[model samples]
Target: MRRNMCRNMCRNMCRNMRRNMCRNMCRNMRRNSERGPTARNRQQRNLKIVDYFRQVFGEWAQVEVVELVNDGSGLAFGIVGGRSSGVVVKSVLPGGVADRDGRLRSGDMLLRIGAVSVVGMCARQAACVLRQCGACVRLLVARPAPSNAAPLQSLGASQAPIVPSRLLADPLDLERRLAEAGHDGFGALCEDTTPTSPPPTVIEESLHHRVRELLTAFKKKLWF
Candidate 1:
């Protein structure tokens, strides 16, 4: 009877091991199949968009630079929340007309493109739309109060013709690293700078406060 029980136990363990191995293999295969094509497709699509900007917009379309307003909490880098902060026509190339006019220059955050707010649209998406036939765009620039910051505003629009640029041609390797880690967006990877984390938000603070109060009340109770 003892021998029979031991044999059954060994058989059961072997069956479990085999099942686990098969499960792991299937999972790996599925993961590889899904990720491989997905990565390639994303890479191709992004490159195509860049190409379309050059093709459809032609030479006349201007590229805009954006400056981010940093919160007092310090910044790893600036990202357009794609929500609150709006995009502006930061600069215009010379011979493109805006450069000829003194009113439009760098530091102007385009509050609106004609009637459209640049809230949801990214720079790439904005450029794509300009390619449409006879699109007239109106841009509102942020004119900050004259102070120390006025210099950053003076960088102004570019006069150089939109020609072959490095940004348009080559894809950055860092992009793939970002994808493997499951981050999506326009900006590059940011390094965390803070050594110690700051205090929690209001909800967390309230929960901690309540828990401490409950513990103190329980300890003060005369009856166990």
Candidate 2:
């Protein structure tokens, strides 16, 4: 009887331990399954952002810092569009802090301005952030390679950096301005716009003049 009782107690203890182990194993598996998709989605989203930057700025997707000291309201550079479409440098004012620094160029994509990540913010939001930063601001930018092709001459001094209110009110005008400046979008600015048949060089012009004279003589001979 004593032996039977001891045997029964051992069996019950073994069964309880097995049940606890199985329960813990199931809980771990459930947690892993639940967390898997979230981790994967985050990774994929990051990859997409990187790819977008690369597509817009070309292979030069490395991040760079641009520091500027603003005395008052502006950073002296204009940002256009939004985080979804991306905020691009629409213009860098001549003799402004950015221009003086020379690292920030028109068409560079802004990743961050100071502590704020400008990546997903619209132009107005970005401008607002810059305004809040007061006198000094640091920027993270991605610059594309300079094209050998000459940019279209500006109609005048590039339009003054648009105010945030103006950006919000007249987004279409902003698009038009960018188009007029020969920037279709982000990557379009760096694309070769050099005329396929460039204006004749000095030597070519002289040759053309001589050919014209020869042609005129041949015409005279035919007439005779």
Candidate 3:
């Protein structure tokens, strides 16, 4: 009887040991996961894409902008992934100052506005800031490669930055200001060749916008 009891005790002890080991292992995993993505890891990540874009373009690179052009295709999507995920641009108003500048495309990331550097801000936040600042805005951005290649780096900036600008912006989306200004919805650029009164030469504005249109369209189509 004692022998049988001893065997049962030994088995219970072994089982208990295993259960404790598993519990400890699980706890460690939970702790590590809770820590989340490290700051160093995030920094080392191919981030700072806009800053790199600014360098690729000249110190005077400008972002092309059309006012009040969401380019959302009738969707109510908030900003994508995280603000740090991609480059952001200044929002445009419908038939406003920036729009008069030229055909500004959505999805372009804004690098520098006039004298300010907008490297690490969310798109909406950046746009709000731009609207607060009056007059013309100069922006530098990165255009995805023409061949539709999966851009150069994994996360950060691009090799060749693109710059576009708009003089006397059309206040793309000043929210309350838009209502105050009595503006309506916006539309895509017409494919016509009606040469409106030209502003100064374009500082590579369309490149980033064209690339972004592709990305935004692709992602949205996949969702709905």
Candidate 4:
């Protein structure tokens, strides 16, 4: 009876192992197929839409850059659009890079992907433009303007192109601001000038307290 039970247990374990291996293999195969020619054909079709937009809009389309990192898995967002509606974000997958970034939202109009324009393209075309973007994707999306803001002026020979009201800070500008703000860390929290003379005990304690207060305020600014 003991021998029979042991054999049964071994058989069950072997069956589970085989099932797991098969499941993994199938998943890998599916991924490879997606990464193959079917994927390339899909991409090509999307690029055609991008080209059509470039021909129509030319360089006059207003756009802003939002950078996102793709972790092997595709940028997780669904798009829906056409010539009438233009390419619009339909949904953002939870826990995906787009969701985590918090910049993209459903109904945001896609302007361009990387160097190519998708302004007037459909969803499939817009997605194709995304596939060409290697690892780091630079998306140009336009959110709805504020309700109180003036309506966008029609394009004309006399008018300069309209720029978005809010723009992401340039990397160089951010670095310069950080330098102006001074270094982070407890030691650099506050500057000390009178190193030649020792500060009074009470004064020293007050200075330390002031440093903690300033640090807390700075952190709050960063968090919010």
TM-scores of the candidates in the order shown:
0.27, 0.44, 0.31, 0.39
lDDT of 2 by residue, 148-192 (tens): 422333333322221122122123343345556544231212222
What TM-score does candidate 2 reach?
A: 0.44
Better of 1 and 3 by lDDT: 3
For candidate 3, the TM-score is 0.31
> In model 1, which runs have C-alpha deviations exceeding 4 angstroms?
1-90, 133-135, 147-224
Candidate 1 weakest ten by summed lDDT: 152-161
lDDT of 3 by residue, 47-103 (tens): 454355444443333223233323333211122213455444335555544455454
lDDT of 2: 0.56
Pairs clashing in candidate 4?
none
Pitting candidate 1 against candidate 3, the one with the higher TM-score is: 3
Compare the candidates by lDDT and give the number of the best one: 2
Q: Between 1 and 4, whose lDDT is larger?
A: 4
Which runs of model 2 end up more than 4 angstroms from their true locations? Answer: 1-41, 146-224
Best by TM-score: 2
Please state the error at residue 155 of candidate 2 in Å: 42
Model 4: per-residue lDDT, tens digit, 66-154?
67899977689999878545787899999998899887887766765655555445788678668877899866565544444333334
**Lowest summed lDDT over 10 consecutive residues: which window, candidate 4?**
185-194
